[model samples]
Target: MCVADGGVKTDRLSPAMVDKLTFLRGVGKQFWDLTDARIVNRNITMLRLGTLLLLCGSVFANELTINKIEDAAKAGQFTNIKIGNIQVPAGQTLHLKGLKAGTKIDFVGKVTFGFKQWEGPLIKIEGKGITVTGSPGHVIDCDGKRWWDGKGGNGGTTKPKFFAARLTDSSISNLNVKNLPVHGFSINSCQKLAITGVNIDVSSGDYANGAHNTDGFDVGSSSDIQIKNCNVKNQDDCLAINSGKNILFQGNTCSGGHGISIGSVGARKDNVVQGVIIKDNVVMKSTNGIRVKTVLNAVGSVSDVTFENIKLVDISKVGITVQGNYLNGGPKGEPTGGVPIRDLTIKNVYGNVLPKGTNILVWVKNASNWKFAFRTLWEVKDKIWRRTIKQDSDAQWRGPGQCFADHPQPRATRFTFP
Candidate 1:
């Protein structure tokens, strides 16, 4: 970042510039002798104005590159930045916040963090209308093995969360992250943000005493966000929405973890997940395929969610699960109506769950207006079995926390296709 040092000192000038200025001055003098003195004075003033403008342009460097962390602040001074392989100091974040709008930041080579036992967003980028990108083959090597003791955020060494992206009306893409220490991308308090083609590989932690609670993307307090074309292989949910609305998770792949989920909502400042669409994704070799778990005895609402065109394979746990008894230790043995679910739709979900796992399980209280259309497959004893179950209003739990319907309790039902 170049700035004014007192003033533009022009005591020394290049020989060529001196010659040009001398020639111009001489020409002015000759014209003054032939014409009016006022005309030569006006010409001289214009020449000086041009010289000052040229000098001022040299003081602002519009492009910057830094290899050290301390110099990272210089990036905010330019519209284009290229960050090379650098290691952030322990307990310090590579702060790229509130940059000039339309700034383009490119991550080149490797970005590593100093090992420390602290809560970290290691990297934070917060602003509007910025482009955060990465070069091909560039990797953000978190080297989480140093912190992986299988007790993520519970006990062991206090590990730092990875990226806290609070962007608005911006797009971040093509990031290759590996060995994530804990939660991968915390997309919080953003609007109109798009994240695409960001691949995460935390499978190395699948070993005993390895990573835990490595959620791929955790969204909260946001709206109009789109996460597409991402691949996550970790030990926790591929994507979890604690609170958000109008969110889209599409064209993604999840493996080696608990599958995609919609909260364990409630207990957060914003505990509503609404207008969410999880479409055309593949979840394979995972524990649970798709699930929505609202915390027991908490006050919130999960409404207007649709899971469409999903494909699951080798899901060792429930293929599709929605429960209202979620607790830390385990389910609370019964559904709690505090967090009512409404207007849920599950359509075109076709996949196979191992015999050990159930195909679809819904245990909720005050859940209403559900329409399920499935083309699923599960084999037992070398024979395929398909069953269509639609139960209509066996009993409705219109407890204190049920979402009050205007008329009689709307038909609370479940419909599955054969």
Candidate 2:
């Protein structure tokens, strides 16, 4: 029996039903006093619903049986259907053709990740304004162990991306994705997309082999996108924004990854990323806290960005960085003037390094008048840069904690570059 919102739907019982009801009633009597009255009342409602349904018709009993979600999907029918076990093995993709505009499809069982030679987006939604929600115990499990040689999505025997959502105006939430052979989630060409409350659990393979580039989420070429309240445990950037605008990331937990990043920008043929807000997030034992990166010779511009209220624990590398040339050892590297970044801010941010070194606080080149003021960027400068920390004991600032021994308090700094 399924009771949802005071409506009872049941498997009609006959003499068999009466017998089972009697048996259940006898079982209920044993614990009736201890059970919640509401639950008992619901059970009684279920019994009554069952009795009425049986008398109404025998066909009612057949309605409760499970059916394939893909079957209805094959016919483009949107119904309240329950799928038990569905498999999309390698060499086959489940295509939902001509999707309804506002359809709600729920998966109860595992959406097994297919192992293949090309990229695997086990599930791809090619429609507009749809929602793909997962309940408890439902997983899009990629058998990443088969391909976790540490090279990740970069190279290997064709690891599949776990989930991909394309087009616009969608909300995908409450899903647990695990063991991605390569990158876990990819958002492409989406406008106004919100991905929340999702868990990316790839921490298992970080040490199991040498998990190299297993990024949890990679957002590319989308505008007005927000990803928040999610947990990513992997080897590469917890979230890598390749290209997008007005992208906001907040309230997330990232551990065992390359922290949160923007760019590897201009890697795309024709795309640029701007207007990013990374706020209220926690980074744990990751490589870097908050960063923006661009290739040495790429032509693009990243401007108007902010990283605020981020808490870092045992970060192994730099605290916050903005660099157009990522190949160099530091953000202050000679700028080729390829992709110019401007209007940056790091406000109310705090981080602690785990020994090795905390490199440059903020670095930029090929931009005029950059400011890291907490409140706002009042003036824009050109072709020069300046970095200020609360106090640096040594001119060399040797390696993170060794130099800034007692500066535990949070401080705001600004970088103005020429």
Candidate 3:
């Protein structure tokens, strides 16, 4: 119930929450009588309202420590509930029915181990300014081996995404996510969100099973978000930023995934992603880096994005690519032209490559007025450009203006002079 020392109490539930405890008791007509309050005297109602207000004022008088959730979840008004030092069980979901401001939840132990296609998010928080953090060295073990046969979202075992949805003004940090059944985390409709200092290790899916598409962080329709100081070593896109404004992603380490992308946009359905910055991140041995691809036929505007100071090593394909008219190769290499890309910048990127026949340093199509600056583009055609494309001896083989030449498109050609 309480943990206190030296006149400083750490955690307790609100008294206003305790006042509502009477409502949870006494079933049938009495429950409705307290909840409905249709027949109560107006003066009595005013007195109860005043009492509730006073209780609320006293709720946070000391830090409200909640270790036992079975008792706290029973409270109706979840305003100002501070959850600290709590160990939750498997197959459990904490629902923030109607949370209010100043609600802080601290996760004390490892998350419940899960397998099978259970309806989840292990933890769900709502309302304003909610903070859910795990103790240092905490883990959310999905027991992915149970579901990972390398076919993640492509239909192996039904895998539930970690943190299925996050509302606004929240932070979930300091945890290790190991072997997710499917996608790791999906951030939804949360403004001013910060997901920092977390690790997602789906590498076990790489060899033991066929880990298909285990994307790390999927951001959709949210704003003012920052995902930094994190590591994602999985099979698919490290960060799939769908639709948002003013996003900041930096100081992250990623490998074995699509290196930091924006879009697959306007493909399934289009949305706007504006004012994004992907800088100072290390991408290792990925399929691509600093990419923005749109659906072939979908309609949307993705603009005002900047990628700078990105480092890549042993990557297999495009060093930096922005293409709109994209078509993935199936058994027959079919092309699907569904979406378009626009208004992007990729700068200060230095990397190695396969033969020019294998990797495209920078590729673009079906976008307008995009800029590529300070790119030391590399191609190993004769293994010359891999060293210096602008060498005096290689001038004959270099495209115009060294690396600043327009992409031989009718429109971009006007920007570069012969």
- Highest-lDDT candidate: 1
**Candidate 2 at 12: error in angstroms?**
15
Q: Once superposed on the true structure, which residue ranges of model 3 sit more than 4 Å away at CA?
A: 1-94, 268-270, 327-338, 354-364, 375-418
Q: Lowest lDDT 10-mer window, candidate 3?
A: 409-418
lDDT of 1 by residue, 109-132 (tens): 689999999999899988889888
Residue 282 in model 3: lDDT: 91
Model 2 lDDT per residue over 1-418, tens place:
3212223333443333344445444444444445566665667767755654454344233222124344634524552233335667774555454555665445556766456677766666666666666756667677678777766655666666666778477787888878777787788878988889999888778785556677777888789998889999888889888888899999999998889887766646745778999999998888887788877766887777777788877777666666665753444344455777767677766657655545345444576445554333433234434342432332122222232335443332222111
Model 2 — TM-score against the truth? Answer: 0.74
Question: How high is each candidate's TM-score?
Answer: 0.77, 0.74, 0.69
**Best model number under TM-score:** 1
Q: What order do you get sorting by lDDT, best first?
A: 1, 2, 3
Alpha carbon lDDT of each predicted model: 0.78, 0.65, 0.61
Q: Candidate 3, TM-score vs. the true structure?
A: 0.69
TM-score of candidate 1 to 2 decimals: 0.77
